[model samples]
Target: MPSDYHHGVRVIEILDGVRPIRTVETGVVGVVGTAPDADPEVFPLDEAVLIIGSRTKAAKLDTTGNGQGTLPGVMDAIFDQIAPLIVVVRVEDVEDENEQISKILGTVDATGHHSGLQALLTAKTSLGIKPRILGAPGFSHHQPVADELGIKAEHLRAFAYVDSPATTVEEAVVHRNLFGNKRVMIMWPAFKVWDTPLADYVYQPASARALGMRAKLDNDIGWHKTISNIVINGVSGLTADVSWELQNPVTDAGYLNANEITTMVVQDGFRFWGSRTCSGDPMFAFESAVRTGDVLADTIGEAHMWAVDKPMSPTLIQNIMDGVNSKFRELKNFSYIVNAECYLDPELNSVESLASGKLWLNYDYSPVPPLEQLGFRAKLTNKYLVELLEVK
Candidate 1:
């Protein structure tokens, strides 16, 4: 908007300096599953549907037919903790479990049509907000289903909460070996909840509460906090009793956590007992760390449209750096990160690259990993005894 053609000299205010970087919203849960009793008009098959916490809207997914559908049950679990914006992708439910899983995994046709979990890819466009926590509660225990969750999570830059087929600690460890991806969370030993229609106690997958609790954590605390040690709701008890002692690694809960499997333990109440991702790398060992990195990257990627196609001026470069560093500083002040810095590397921003309209900005950060363990060295010393006597 240069007004240079005017005869009268008009001062055009030039906006300069730090541009605000808007962060992508977190805590939105995206899920793919089947719902036999769900209303077609409300939740059509192979489509992404947005469902807020309206009982009337949620009641459309009725369970009067053949049991409560996977989506209904999963949503119930999530609602127990906190109301969240959920994107649901309902697939065709059939008698054959394998065939149903195939539908859940979905397909991308030559026509660019997406089905099943693939529908999640279109959520941001259709629903206006993408899901940050991904899962398929009843079916995610299968290897193919969990693998699909992983693929969708990486594409969406989200976290995958998966249930393990393992009913015991050792078996859960076997399932843990199957995954090394940082975004994948391994949960075991489904919790038991009351089934109103069936009039009995039914075991719900670990994903039932994991997804809800993650949303609560992202909302209550920052994305850097791990989803462990939080009291779980809407569950009577765990299907199996996993032992726990604060300092006892020999306990089943301790053993499971050591192998990167998250399970429910009966403490003050039923609480999640682990803070690990199924990552072999030490850097991304914790789920909180991986999420911190993802949230930061996604937020930065979605922001900065105004900077695009602008001339490669020193002022533009400084503006970009200042904006990003502003977000980093905010995250640090909120305790999401220990510390961070954004800088343009001179070596990476070479003359050839800048001439070609390519710029590389590097940001280094340390995510606040949860305190998984703490220890103290103790010794029977005469010095401590003397101090106690003198103090008395």
Candidate 2:
């Protein structure tokens, strides 16, 4: 959703689309020097916990040359109205500068104030209030500030509204607590493979080793012979017998870049979406293809593609290949293209993307340290090269 937290209230409302529904009752507490003419009680205070910081010293907002008393008394009325979820947002006036001015005016320059609210909300959350803090522009800092305030970052979902900006803390609380039950799930696949007594920690699986070996042998002979043969035959002309040096085993987190995956597939005559790349789940490939054209349906949710990061036995690889192929058959015209970089140990001589010939296996790369920092040698011999390509 587009957000306008950087600007004024009117801009916030204009940019932030519809108003979210406030399902939780929370006391909106804050110390603001200035307040809008509208009463806070008239706002959404019924089920909310409301607390106002009384200014013993005439609030700066009230003493300005053209100032009309806007806050203190209004706070009294708001406190009397709707009882709500309780938390405190303390406002302390720093020196009289633009910083102080913005703070007094509720212009989003209040990190401390926001932090205070996050703390208060967090306390409420601890008590099971599930408080959500919504803030404009500067308030987005709430994420880290909340952390500093000993509050859980996820507990306070921050948002920006450019148009019809929240006039008071109460309004801000309303927007924050109301983001529909819209939750986003981000997925990534772990694609690492190892062999022999679990040689690679990142991709360790005795089962995978057994499975991969079986699959490799079966593939070499004939399982999914049609596709395998086609792929082998088509690229056989470009195959080379050159020995290439492979290096740098990938760590647990490091993997191929998203763009690299897309390019690899497109080059292999497959179409894919950058956003559709799933990390560990192969089913997402089919789901991504199905939702390709449906805008609403395609709003990806709880779906992704990922690589299993264990030493794959030939049988495991075969299972993966078969599973994907079956889904591809159902989807029709779908070609499997993994967007992540294939992992190779440093002991492996080299990777060759040949234009023709048989895939020659020479050196075993499993024995070398996977860490790139251990000082691995780089080889220029070209078996296969990574190329930058356009996303289809």
Candidate 3:
């Protein structure tokens, strides 16, 4: 019998490539709240982690009417306003409200248990995703929850959209005074959502809606655009109608603004009418500036990941600087930033530091500030009479 023989050969190709800096994904929101038992079909609920991709999946996991129903409502609000990617972290259900709050605050030991807010803090390790925006929706009103989220956002280089615990404008002003973190944006006076089953408009935290609006803003315009003055779509109405006059500095809204709290008002529609962070520092007062800085830091960090193990040399430093400068040039061209530059100072990056395998990079960028105020001057003049005489 004749035997058939075959010869096998394999080819391998190696390509040298430099990974260019990329803009991190914006508008991805990380939500931590309570959910019913996990549906194996939708997501591994038992794992207490889910990255919802569609409104249908969100509806399936909707816990809108449960005791802790506001979580689903927040999710629905986000979906209604804008279709941003949502990462849901479902906490363990406990009967006691106090115990639940403690669990969410991460006060209780999470060993062999599903930690609530702690889950979100460790989402990158557990779920393989990092959200640019973080919120607890219904829970953000709680001081502890808001504080924890603010700390997380600051540490993770993200933004925290929080709601004031105040039910009235007056209370919101007081609550706003308690916060002063650039990473946090406190929204006041929840909006009314029409409940289908109850056939009534129920008040819900505006943080969810604000996050959705910010996501929409980032998607529609660049991230540097101010989130204020935009219509908050998919809301029946604000819980309370705040007048434009009252929003002035001498009024409640003004005080709230001083404390870094944003409020919505009834205009042509329910509009997000403020844009400032809780940071007491005037340098980072504007939310857009804070956000732009965060985006730049994240983008630069990601871009330089490849330089970690490479030998530290002048060429390596120049290459890194060139890449970052290129990105900043694009951003400046897009008007996202006024100007930006990257360089290494000889004093900062000394021979000792280079010998020790340490490199120093100086990055400076002027973010486009929001036009929060405008002034007009009027004068009566007779120039029109001269022009008319000349014409005659």
By TM-score, the best candidate is 1
Please give, for residues 1-392, the per-residue lDDT of candidate 1 as tens digits.
57457777777677677988877888999888878888999989999988875655766777464455788788788889988888888888899988988999999999998999999999989889889899999999999999989989999999999999986778889988999888899998999998767889999998978998998988898688899999998889888888888988999988998899988888788899889998889999998889989988988888888889988789999999999999999988889899999998999988999889999999999999888889899877676666666754
Worst 10 residues of 2 by lDDT: 225-234
TM-score of each: 0.95, 0.20, 0.88
Q: For residues 119-205, write the lDDT of model 3, one tens digit per residue.
A: 565666776667778888878888889999898788778888998887677888788788888988889878888766566778888
Per-model CA lDDT versus the true structure: 0.87, 0.25, 0.76
* Number of the candidate with higher lDDT, 1 or 2: 1
Ranking of all predicted structures according to TM-score, beginning with the best and ending with the worst: 1, 3, 2
lDDT of 3 at 354: 79
Q: Global lDDT for candidate 2? A: 0.25
Which of candidates 2 and 3 reaches a greater TM-score?
Answer: 3
Top candidate when judged by lDDT against the true structure: 1
Candidate 1 backbone clash number: 0
Q: Against the correct fold, how does model 1 do in TM-score? A: 0.95
